[model samples]
Target: MQTIPDELTNIIASKSQKLAYQLRVAWDLNDFLATITFAVVGTSVVSGQDIVKGNAAAVTEWDKYTYENETQYVKKYEFIRETGFPLNSVIKSRASIVLDNTSKRFLPHALPFGTAVEIDDCDVATGWTQSQDGIAPTISTSRKEGTNSLNCGINTAASENTYAQYDKAPSVIDISSIADADKKIALFLYVKDKTKLATANAVEIRIGSDATTNYYRIQIVNSEILQNGWNEIKKAATKVGTPVQTAIDTIRVIFNEATVPASVTLGDLKIDYIRICDSTEEDNYIGSFIRGGRFIKLFSGYNAYSIPQFVGMTDRPKNNIKLAETIINAYDVLHYLETWQMSTGYLLEDHRGDEVIAQVLADAGFTAGQSSLETSMMTIPFTWIKKGQKALDIIRKVCEAENATFYVDEEGIMCFENRYHLSQSPHTSSQYTLDYDEEIIDVGLEPTEVINKAKITAMPREVQASQKIFEKEGASVINAGETLELWAEFQDDYGELPCTAITEPTAGGATSYFKGNTSENGTETDKTNDLSIITWETLGGTVAKMIFTNSGASKVYLTELVIFGTPAKVVKEISYETPDTDAQESIDEFGLKFYELKNDLIQSADYARTLGDTIVYSFKEPKKSLETTIKGLPHLQLEDMVTVNEGSTGETYYMYVAKIEKLAEGYFYKVLLREKVIQSYAIVG
Candidate 1:
């Protein structure tokens, strides 16, 4: 839970309180850009006209025409248009420019050029032709720019190129005068079904004459399309064959059936608009542009205290050009770990829980934040993290081994809390109490699953003494360009040894290769001098073999071989049954409820037993799970403790917040909670 000011607590509990939400996005690390708000009062602030910074007064003709292409940012005030939502106006006005949480950010984004010429807005279905391989073009209400978009569907039997071409009279725009060097086009499309378009070349944009001989084609890859909203594809115009610029009269959108699946149904594609402009006019627009990796902070509160509720980096942003609105979706900094893999393997021998977490975070380029992890309780004996494993997955395993929880806080910092975090500084009383009938808008309680028994299994690695596997009384010789093979079996007590290194008493002139197999007759893998120690350790076995090939001019002799490795063993298993008589009675009434866990990271028998005991104690009996809606408390976070008094059942519940969802425009929060059980732990002074 986030710490809040003392005064804000009283403000949250008030019956009638004001609510406000502020959104700020960082341009980089140090500079934050505020949301732009403007009012349309008569002709003072018109759309597509220059907005003078900090000046809302009537603009003179000189200033209006001089800076018509720029949008000025107002630093300290907001403006609202006096007229209600404008209807049927060529120029569209926006109340505010703020991206919501559901937007997808695009890569290589640019502002709409003010001098761009519209080829087609897809406002009507006429003046377009579709190939016989697919359905005809139709206008759809689902649009990104205008009132409608062009929809095209694929025939189930389409096995050839399917396309929608705008080649009819009045529909084909003349771009012959535009030189190829300065010619560029931008396309906006929304894919209804992504599964239909499976390959990178599923869509293509072609600009050429109606005869189809001269054209420039741009193939769209799978990564360029967004599954949620419109995708903007931009490319420079270049000729394909011997081209006649004056003869260019068609703009074609091809659905390459060779790349699309045969199972694609009708009506799976929608095109919003296509614009043609000079390459030099790319950045002439009237709005701000946002990209990924920017920081986003959301604040919610009343007049006096506006506390930050969510702080994270922008992941995606979706823009509506017609509405002049952009929505941004963000995730906390810890999410970066999911994209990073463990490039280097680690052999953790004697590291604490906190130390392990900190090392992993540092290697992944994150600074560790607050932690309540147990540092002195136990040290990890031996844990091997393989290369290419996800960093987040390894961290979760460490958390499971330590019995801890981890998350990113509101400050965008990674945090870890052990099982005893809450108990270490125990709360004697609830921080806040609420009357269910008055504060809660809705409430419910359901019985949770009961677990009377728990079992845990763990595998611990044990290092063994080095031993000589093979020895020969006579010299074993390999002639030049000849190869020899030797076989040896490990001791019966040590079934499979993870061989770390193989050494010969005397350095043999022949290049040596080694491998371990379960059986002597097993097919041998290709041997090389580059020994992968970790790979051999992972594939443990009993029998061992070596191959020697003579690459020198003379024969080579080898006498003995020795191997060093640690033995892999499944040595620990722990079981615990609830001791409470009530729990046993419930189990007898209902059949045995069992839970089991298997984690190789739990290296100690005592640790496994303690984990099982904790599980059984927590789930001994049926506990109540609840969901309720109450006035929004932005300070409340996941796993925070709260008390509620139920009027209907005349009961009190001390529960932990499981999930929280803001409802009705941030005025209320729908919370889910589970019964909290206080465990007894021995304390030392």
Candidate 2:
């Protein structure tokens, strides 16, 4: 929950109050693009109006100005008269003058890019490594396509051999197939270093199977190829080694000097992208990284003292323009996790609940702040296999494993709290209290469902070892713009186990992974590598197929294929029943009430039993849930403990805030709460 000021708390406790809200959007911190304000009841004076000579008197609210020659302007309005004779004054006749009158309100403006914050400068080349030989290449802020560029510095000694090499993973690159498709492959490099262009004689680019094996070299000697900011240099690579390329593993850049000098250092030689493409298809092969850091800030207060209500990353704004106003709708940072999927081959095994949650958030580029994610009480291992699963789903699964709650707090930070959070000493006490007859406008209470039986199903990975479901040897090729489908049947009678992962163990593995759909009729789920069980009861057993498509200009090669999954024998189940006589009587009166949960993260029977007991104990009896409309309380957060007085029944209830909604132009709050109960036994003296 947010901390409210003492003065503001006193103001809120008063009978009457003033309310105001401000919404701000920006690309980064301290760099605001738009700031809008809305008040409950207020008036604003419109300013900046044009004035004409000999027109009606200036209005009280609008400012007036006069201009001549389109460049000079004065704040006062004036008119002039001409004299015809030297001694006698004469009024000159002139046509009625016309002036443009336009009025506009003053508003904040957006700042220039890279002026308010530092630009992202991380190396964005995925699945690649870099090495330097007598020359240091570092990530630089200057970029042409992506978040950053690579700075290739020259050697201090002129005669020394210096070069920087970027090496791609061997499993993802196939030069043999690329050469077969296009004999004249082109190397596209974007470089910029105007200050030190004269210190180098030429720039040499090398692409090869390895650092010193079969390779191709291109020498760029023209000074025009180097520019002040960014220049795209395209050159067709020529074979320098074995006359034919079999594989591509490394790309090297060298800055050469003609004369041997005492020292020659290229200050800033930045390279954006080093793309290898077919000579005819140059632009289609370039790729870029998506930029982030857009966020929103919401503030609420009375008069001048405002407190931050919500600060979060924003989705794309939806703007609606009408005759009188423009409204924008934006979502919070949690929306990204709901839409983002975990990458292929992402697996977590034998990790704690909090560790798994932290890993998932880190993989999605989010940081968990002020978190209370306690370790699970169970000693069993937890496993999560990422097969096109959303990040939010994984987080929720982990939360369920630990019986915890996860949310984005008001400060745009991820917060995780275990079930013990509310049951703990200080948190078990009410944080605030409200009088039903005085503070609440309306209130209603309804009876909630009672559960007498609870069941939990757990799937543990240790019960069954991962068995190889499919295997293939030798090379398999897929032509450009074509698809390749492979199928395999399950060897054992293990019912309903998902294929976990697909891998290539041979050297120089598959060229690239493509996105495709997976189904018996090719219409169901879509994924990067369509590896799914399409036919469960076909070919006398369970059969699965994977479809691979080559969407690029070059052909793709898969050297080996292996698929593995755990059998369904690992699944375990546990059940619990309420032992209290009152709970049994309520169950008999209301008919049997049941609740069940199936989670792969719950591995131990003890843990499952504890979870079941917690669920059944909380729902053993009918509980009163309340929904009330009350004065605005911006400091209150979800899951906060609050006490509510019931004037009709003359009773007070301590409840947990389940949900909160702002209404009536942010001046009131509608809140839903559930009764909090203690389950432990106490002995009387």
TM-score of 2: 0.49
Error of 1 at 418 (Å): 1.6
* lDDT at position 513, candidate 2: 25
What are the clashing pairs of model 2? none
Best by TM-score: 1
Query: For residues 581-674, what per-residue lDDT tens digits would candidate 2 score against the true structure?
Result: 5367767877778777777777777777777777777777778888888777777766678888888788888887766765534367677777
Measured with C-alpha atoms, the lDDT of residue 143 in candidate 2 is 49
- Give one digit per residue, the lDDT tens place, for model 1 in 1-685: 5677877777776766855566555432211112221211121124533112221111111111111101122111111111100000011111222432122232223335434666677778787777645577777654545456787777766555444333333344666656777777777777655556646676777766643667766777666776534556676765687555555566777765544335444445777667666776544231233444444555667766777665554544556565545544555544556656665666565676677777676665443333233453446665556566777777777766656666655544456665466565434346556578777878887776677777777766644445453343444555656777655544434354333334432233232323322223323432222222222222223445556565555544543344433433334443433354536776786668877766677777777777777776776667788878887677776666788898878888788776666553447777777775655555444
TM-score of each: 0.54, 0.49
What stretches of model 2 exceed 4 Å from their correct place? 27-294, 313-323, 368-380, 463-582, 678-685
RMSD of each: 19.5, 24.9
- For model 1, the local distance difference test gives 0.54
